[model samples]
Structure formats: structure tokens, C-alpha cells
Target: MKRSVIPREFFCRYTPEVASDLVGCRLVRVIRGRRISGIVVETEAYRGPKDPASHAYRGKTSRNGVMFGPPGHAYVYFTMGMHFCLNVTTEPTGTPGAVLLRAIEPEEGIAVMVKNRGPIAVDRLASGPGNLTKALGIGKELDGEDLVMSDRIFLEHGRMAREIGTSPRVGVSAGRSTRWRFFERGNRFVSRGRPSSPQNP
Candidate 1:
């Protein structure tokens, strides 16, 4: 199949829209000349300043400066001193917004994903943000990389989810009422996590 990279314009909108629309898109990463990819299954939007759960909520730092840069770029960050999470920058230039890629359904390069992630169930290989990055061999090196024009990593058009579900973002205390988490309903590859508080109707 001919794969078309998602344009930068696609991410130059509201952060929540980009997060929701990213579901079912393909995230491709090239490692050692091999392509490892999967269909995006879950995401969470973070609007800077307004979103208390966002890294850019306070202001831009050396680590989060990329989020204040142009859209369609990768914003990778280390968390808990162990895991690296992958997020795609959203909104227009100078706007601090991003969509955290929560999970993905493994598509191509299963063996490589298995190797990268160790012996795990196919569905679990990329079922969480950290795991998804590990499975695709993504790390701090790809931070701030241009997803729209980069050959090493990029997004592609894929099968859209038939049913998308929404909920409050997991592990966040402040944005409990905001339903910014989006996932493909009934997708086995989607991560399993509940919000810190009840979601508002």
C-alpha cells in the first residue's frame, strides 16, 4: 500500500481535535533501516497553560521548548526516571499543545517490536505510551524531530476507528473533568487505565 505522511497542517488545530483525529493513524519508526509501525489506538490531549496536567502548563523550559515550537514535531520526555513517553506537538507555532500517544495496534515489524519490547503479547507490545515507544525504538534522540518531513519517523494515513471513546486523562488530578482521552472502542491494543476522578457529563 502507498503510505502518505500526515501533513503538518493536520496538527495545526485544536489539541483535542488532533488527539481524537490521531486515532487509527499509523505511527512509523525506522530503526536500523527497518520499519516498525502500528495503528494509533489511544491518545490524550494537553492544552498548555490551560491544562494543568501538561508539562508546558507553567512555561517553556529547556526540556519542553519543543512544545512551544512548530506543530507536527515529536515531543519526547522521560518520566519516573525510567520510561520515555512520546507526544506529538499540536496547534500552530508558538502554541504549547500536544497529544500524548497512549497506545497503538501493532501493524508491521512484529518481530522487531518483540525484540525491542521483549517477550510480550502482541497486543501488549505497544499498549502503553512507554511501551509503544520502546516497541518502536523511540527515545530521547527523536525528541523535537520533525514528524512531517522526517524519514526516520512519521505518521501515515490508516484505517480510521469505527467507534471512538472518550474519557478523562489517566493519572492526572487537575484535568479530571476534561474528557481529553480518546481511544478506539473495543480495541485490544488500547491501554487500560482509569482517570483519577469521575469524568464530568
Candidate 2:
């Protein structure tokens, strides 16, 4: 079947809208000549300076500069000094916004994902942001990559999720009350993470 790559226009909109719409899309990563892919099952929207939990909330930095770039780009970041998380830039240029890819249902390369994630269950291979990156071989080196143009990493059209659930983002303190997290209900590949507690005054 011919692949339908998602267009940049799809991401040049409100961050929350893009985040919700991203559920069920296919995220593909090509490492060497092998293709690894999965159906996006969970996402979290971070609305730039307006979202205190966002990396761009404090203004653009070298690490978050990709968030302020054109839409449909990868904004991969290293976190906890150990893992990498993948995000897709949203909104127009100068507008800092992104949709963090929280989880995915592994698709194209199961054996490779198993090798990458060790002896984990298939459903848990890409069940969280960090593991999703690891399963697909995503890292900081792919940061700022133009998803619309890059053959190495890109998104493709997939069946739209039938039941999408929304809740506050996970592991965030300041934006704990915002229902920006979107996930496919009943998806085993979705992360089971709960929201972090609100920050102290």
C-alpha cells in the first residue's frame, strides 16, 4: 500500500487540536535500512509560554528552540539524564507549541523493538515516552528534524481512534489541572502514568 505522509499543514494549528488528532497516526522511524513504526496512542499538548509545565514556558533556550520553529518538526529531548522523549512541533513559526508523543502501539518492527527494550512484553515496548523513543531509536540527534521532509522519521495516516480519552498531562506539576493529555481509550499500549501533584505555592 502506498504511504500517505501527514502534511505540515496538519500540525500548523492549535496544539491541543493537533495533540488529539494525532492519536492513531503512524509514527515511523528508519534506522539504517530497517523500518520501525507504531500507532500513536497517547499525546500531551504543551502550549508554550502559557503552559507553566512546558519547556518553552521560560522563553526559548538552546534546548527548546525547536519548539519555536515551524510546525511538523521533531523536538526530541533528553530527560532524567537518561531517556529521550519525542515531541512534534505545532503552531506557526514564532509560536512555541508541541505535542509530546507519550505512547504507541508497536507496528512495523516487533523484533527490533524487543531488542531495543529488552525482554519486555510487546504491549509495553513503546508504552511510554521514553520507551517509545527507545523502541524506535529516537534520540537528541533527531531533534529539530523536519518531519514533513525527512525520510528518516515521519508520520503517516492511519485509522482514527474510535474512543479518545482526555486527562491532565502526566508527570507535570504546574499544568496538572489542564486536560491536555489525549489517549485512545482501552489501548493496552497507552501509558498507565498518573498525573503529578500540583506544585506548592
Candidate 3:
């Protein structure tokens, strides 16, 4: 199938609801001589200030300042002393809210993903936050870069992805009352289901 690249206009138009609804879209990253694409199997939503699950809750800092920038940008960050996670800036410029890409099922460029991720089963690679970023070669350098024009990464319009499911976000202490995260049900690529809420569905 031809890649369904998302246009900058569509990306810029995204709201927190739209971002949350992007769970099953395909995420594609063009690497050295390879095009790695995957069905975005999981996602999380963070509303600024009001949503305790958001990084902007602490207000914009040197690390999270990019969240204050324009939409269609990448927001990569490190955590757990060794892992790097990825997020996409949402809402308009100066407004802070984001959609966290939680998981993806490896589709194209399995060999490339394997090369970046070291030895792992094809299905296991790019299955979690850290692994997905590693497999796609995403790092702090791409942190504030615009995904709409980035030569290496961009989002595609996978209309079928709307069939995706929703649950509360993972590893969050706040915003535990509402269901905000999204994922593809039954897809092994879904990262561990340690949600902030008591239920998974």
C-alpha cells in the first residue's frame, strides 16, 4: 500500500481529542535505505495545567519548553534513569497538551528495526516506548523538530486506526479517574498495561 502521509495542515489542525483518537494510525520513519512503518498500537493524552498527567503541569521548563511550541513537533524525553520516551506536541503554539505514542506494531522495514534494536523477535521490537524510539532512531535531537517536515519521521492518515480502543494512561498517578490512553485491542505490540486506572478497558 502507498504510504498515507499526513499533510502539515491536517497535523496543525489536531486537537487533544484528535490526538487521542490517533491510536491506530501508522507511524513511519525513513532510515538509511529503509522505510520503517508501524501501526500505532497505543497512545496517551495529556491536557496542559488541568491534566495532572501532563508535563506542562510543572509549567514550561528548559526540558519541556518544546511543548509550548507549534503543533506537529516531536517531544522526546528521558526517564527511569535510562529510557527515552517520545511524544507529539498538540494544540496550537503556546498551548501545552500532547499525545504520547505508547506502542506500535512493526510493519515495514523489519530488518531496519532489528538493526537499530539489536536482536529481538520481530513482533517484540518497537513494541514499547523505549524500544519504539530506539527502533525509529528518535532522540533528543528530534525533540522539538517539526514532524510535518522532518526528513526522517512523519505521521500518515490511517483512517482504519480509528477502530482503536481506549483506557487510562500508564504509569500515571494523577488523572487516574478518566480513560485517556488508546490502543489496538489484542495487538501484542501494546506495551505493558500498567494503567493509572484500576481497569484496563
TM-score of 3: 0.88
Question: Please, what are the lDDT tens digits per residue for candidate 2 over residues 22-129?
Answer: 998999999888889989999999987779999999998999999999999999999999999999999999999999999999889899999998997999999889
For candidate 1, write residues 1-201 as lDDT tens digits. Answer: 655999999999999999999999999998788888999999999988888999999999999999999999999999989899999999989999999998999888999999988998998999888888888888899999999999999999999698888988887889788989998888888888753433232
Assess each prediction's global lDDT (C-alpha) against the native.
0.90, 0.91, 0.77
Candidate 1 segments exceeding 4 Å error: 1-3, 194-201
Candidate that beats the other on TM-score, 1 or 3, i.e. the better one: 1
Output the TM-score of candidate 2.
0.94
- Candidate 3 regions exceeding 4 Å error are 1-3, 12-15, 195-200
Candidate 1: C-alpha RMSD to true structure equals 2.4
TM-score for predicted model 1 compared with the true structure: 0.94
What is the C-alpha lDDT profile of model 3 across 1-201, one tens digit per residue?
764666655545445576655776778887775788888878877767888888898799999898888887889999988778888878878888778887888889888888889998877798778888988888887888788778788888664753566676778899988678777666777777553433345
Model 1 is weakest, by summed lDDT over 10 consecutive residues, at 192-201
